[model samples]
Target: MFKIKKQISKLYMASILGNLSLTGAWVAILAARGYSLVEIGIAETVFHIFSLTFEIPSGVFADVFGRKQMLVVSSIMRVIGSICMICSKNLTMVCAAIACFAVSYNFSSGSGDALAYDSLKLVGEEARYERYAANQLILYRLCNGISTLCAGFALFVGYKIAYASDVLVTCIQIGVLLSLREIRLDHTGTDRKQEVLQSVWKELRVCFVESLRFLKKAKRAVFLMICNSFVGAVDIVLLFFLQAKLPQTGMPDSALGSSLFIMEMGGILGAKLILWCKNLRYRWVFAVTSVLVLCGVLIEHTGIAVLMTLGGFVAACSDDALQVRTDAILQEMFPSEQRATLISMESFTFSVIMIALSPLAGIVFSVW
Candidate 1:
């Protein structure tokens, strides 16, 4: 059991605020809106665009303006987007809401951690990265559990209550943002703002060139990113299962939350387990995924809810472990020149596949 440390201060708390609030309502809120597979697919498409377009830019923004400032802006955008989502009942409003949310996330995505990592490096705590990273995962899982559990309760109260809960979390995110300690980049009283226009152009150019270089050189690593994406896309198929079961069970929101809760909990165990793996890049993920796919097929064929749930657990653990391992590997190998863009592209490709697969999943579950 990793005890929460005294050194793990407000910065860690502040860093995760955005993800904590955003993760909770993201899936449940979409389901509540009654958007179909196609609509959800479109929303995911926008997410990919925002994520891809902003990935490198946001990191550059951090490099330029400092990470803490960008996070505040990110939280603000998320609040606005959530409000947009709450107001709209149709797919268009949902789409618009997604667009705003994507924009917000794009601006804030990779930068927060980059800022933290740099801070750690400055302090010569680079070796502790894995431990702290694992702790963050634990906190994420615990927070995710609480948030989704709250969403489940809110569903019993009403869908509006759930939406309201999201708004409140955004408020939490805002407060967390204000409390963050600001660190100046490179110990320079001379600010990145001095070279704003030049840095902007340089950033754009470097992002493009470096992203290409990473993709070209890191073939095996890139393969893992692809697998991560495709597996994630397939994971969304379980949503159709939840959606179809909801009306019949006489409560939809709670069912959706409970379904997600299972996966999140499974992810908790899977995340910490990554540190124990000796040869994750060479063996574990491929072996785990192959076996898990068999479980997926069985879950589908038998239509046993328990088996399906277990399948989700297996999938979540395997996927989460594989992703963390892959991300750690990439971070270790890639230089700052193109790290964000390469990571973004990997995520973008996955989101694209997820977008396409959502509809196919809808078709399959509809028939089943």
Candidate 2:
């Protein structure tokens, strides 16, 4: 594990806080709104729909139009969705809200990594990627816990309050982006494009072609992406499992909030701890992911909210470490220019698979 440069560490905090504020209120808000288990599943479906629909184009835009540009646009979309949530509670309103939020989310997903990577490249310190990875994980954890704590207080007052807070957070993130130097991480800027948003067929062809072209160019990168995706999928399993079992405990809100907060706290600790790790002889991520899924199974088959919470902690620790290691490996393997495209391709594929399976996974957990 390496140390993140001071500048990267500072901006990372803002990014983490912005993300946590968005995610923290979301699950609790939907649950409080009387969305049934199935309806919640459908909402998740809508989220993925937004992801699936936007992933490739957003990736291209992040590459070509500039990450900061996409990020600012994403911030505005998030603020709009938060406002929608504040004003309405009807099914149509909720669906509209999900659509808006999902677009913001999908739009911003890989762009953050793209921006961070570019910043490192421009500073001629791309070798320090592992440090950035670890710091990012820790900040994400710290913000998650804080957001949930904030959410509990907000919800005690009202869920709308929590949504409004998210709006404020996004506004702050926009300012943070403006503070950073413009980054063209890759030597050749990715933003050159000749036409309007391409047709679905054109987009599909570009995503696959660009992905495959990069794959042939960097074999080691393909391996890292495969490993990252496999490990990341296990996370989806645990997430949907929570969607099922939290409702079963009859203390759904508190259970989800407490467990999520604890789990994220573990992530904060684990990420910091990674900087202290002295060796790379361990496959810790695989170990932790296995435990997380096992805990999900046990929590579902038995009445073990305590174990579920513990599982969340274990899962978080593993994921944080896994991501740092993956970044270190991939950064070393890929040329700077293609790194963003490859990562976006991997994420787009992962989201596609998760969307197809997440609903079925939720349904199975609910029945069992």
Off by over 4 Å in 2: 1-10, 20-25, 185-211, 217-220, 240-244, 247-256, 273-288
What lDDT would each prediction earn against the true structure? 0.60, 0.66
TM-score of 1: 0.81
User: How well does candidate 2 match the true structure in TM-score terms?
Assistant: 0.83
lDDT of 1 by residue, 1-368 (tens): 21223224555675456456433645444655565545665566666656665656665565555566777777777778778867877777777777777767766556555544544554556456665666666676667655665655654565555555567876787786666554443332221233346556775676577667767887977777787777666654553345344443454555656765676677678778887884655465767765674466456545555566667667666666666666666566655434444555666677567656656665555556
Compute the lDDT of residue 107 as modeled in candidate 1. 60
Among all candidates shown, the one with the greatest TM-score: 2
Candidate 1: the clashing residue pairs are: none
